[model samples]
Target: MGRWEPNARGRLERAALDLYLERGFEQTTVAEIAGRAGLTERTFFRYFADKREVLFWGSAALQEHLVDAVAGAPDCLAPIDVIAGAVEVAGERMQERREGARRRQAVIVANAELRERELIKLANLSAALAGALRERGVDDPAASLAAEAGIAVFKIAFQRWIDDDDRDLTSLIRESFGDLKAVTAGT
Candidate 1:
C-alpha cells in the first residue's frame, strides 16, 4: 500500500497540474489538489507553500547545484566560462529526467500563472548566478553580464531540447552556448 501510494511531492505536483490544465490556475484550490493526490491539505502545505509552488519543486535544488558548480570550478577559467560550466553541470543533472522535464514544461506552457512563476524563478536564478560569480572574485559589470548570458543560453537550450526530439538537453545547452558565443563575436 505504501509503495503504491504516489510520492507525496510528485503527487501534489501532478494533481496541481491536472487541476490547472482542467479548470485553470485561478480557479483551482489547494484543498482540491490535496484531495486529488490522496493527501491531506496539511500534507500539501508541508510540501509546498501554495498550489503555484508545486510547479517549482526542483528550482531551489537547481540553484544550489549551480552555485556548487561555480564554487568548484578551476581558478584558471574565465568568469563567463565559469558560469557556462555551471549551466552545463546543471543541464547534466536535468538529463536524468527527460519525461518529467517535458511534462513540467508542458504544464508551465499551458498555464499563464505557471509561466509567470517560471519567469520569476529564472530571474532569481540569474541573480544567484551573479552572486556566485562575485563570490569567486569576478568584477561588477562582467559578472552580471556573464550570469545573464549564461541564463539566456540555458533558456535557449531548454527550448531547443523541447523542439529537437532527437537531441539530449546537455548537448543542446553546449550547442546553445557555442551559438551565443558566435552571435556575440559576429556583432
Candidate 2:
C-alpha cells in the first residue's frame, strides 16, 4: 500500500492523531509526532503553535466554508433555512474526503483531550456562524439560537454519518436538520 505524503500542516495533524491514539494525548511528545510525520520539530512549530492545536487546525477553513455558504445563500431564505443550507454545504465538503473524515473522528473518539478540543472547535464554529448571521442583519437571540441549533444538528448528523455503513454525510445532515426542526416544533 502507498503511504500518503501529507502536506506540512496535515502531516502534523496526522502525526498528532496517531500519537494520541497510540500513547494517549498527555504522553505524546512533539518530537515523536514530528518524527512520525517525517518532519522536524521546527516544521511542526511552523504549522501548529502546540500539540493541542492539531485537533483544531482545520477548523478555520471549515468556518470559512460555512460563512461563505451562508453569505452566498439566496436572500429570500429564512434564517434557519440559511443555516441549514450552510450546514449542508459544509457536509458536502467533508463527504469528499471520507478516509480523512473517518480518521479524524476516530482520533477524537479515542482520546478525551481530543474530544475536549473537538467540543471547543464546535463551540467556536457556532460562534462564527452566529457572527455570520449577524452580518446578514440577523438580530441577537435569534441569531445565536439558530447558529447553536444548526451546530447541534450538524453534530448529530456527523455522528450518524460516521456510524452508518451506507449513508452519506450530506443526506445525514439533511435528515438531522429535519429532525432538529421536528424537535423544536414540539417545544
- 1-187: candidate 1 lDDT, tens digit per residue: 2333458888888788788777877789999998999988888887798777777878999999999999999999999899889999999888877766777788789777678889999999999999999999998999999999999999999988877789988888888888999999996
Q: Best TM-score goes to which candidate?
A: 1
What's model 1's overall lDDT? Answer: 0.87
Q: All candidates' lDDT scores?
A: 0.87, 0.86
Clashes of each: 0, 0
Residue pairs with clashing backbones, model 1: none
Task: Note each model's CA RMSD in angstroms.
Answer: 2.7, 3.9
Rate residue 169 of model 1 by lDDT: 86
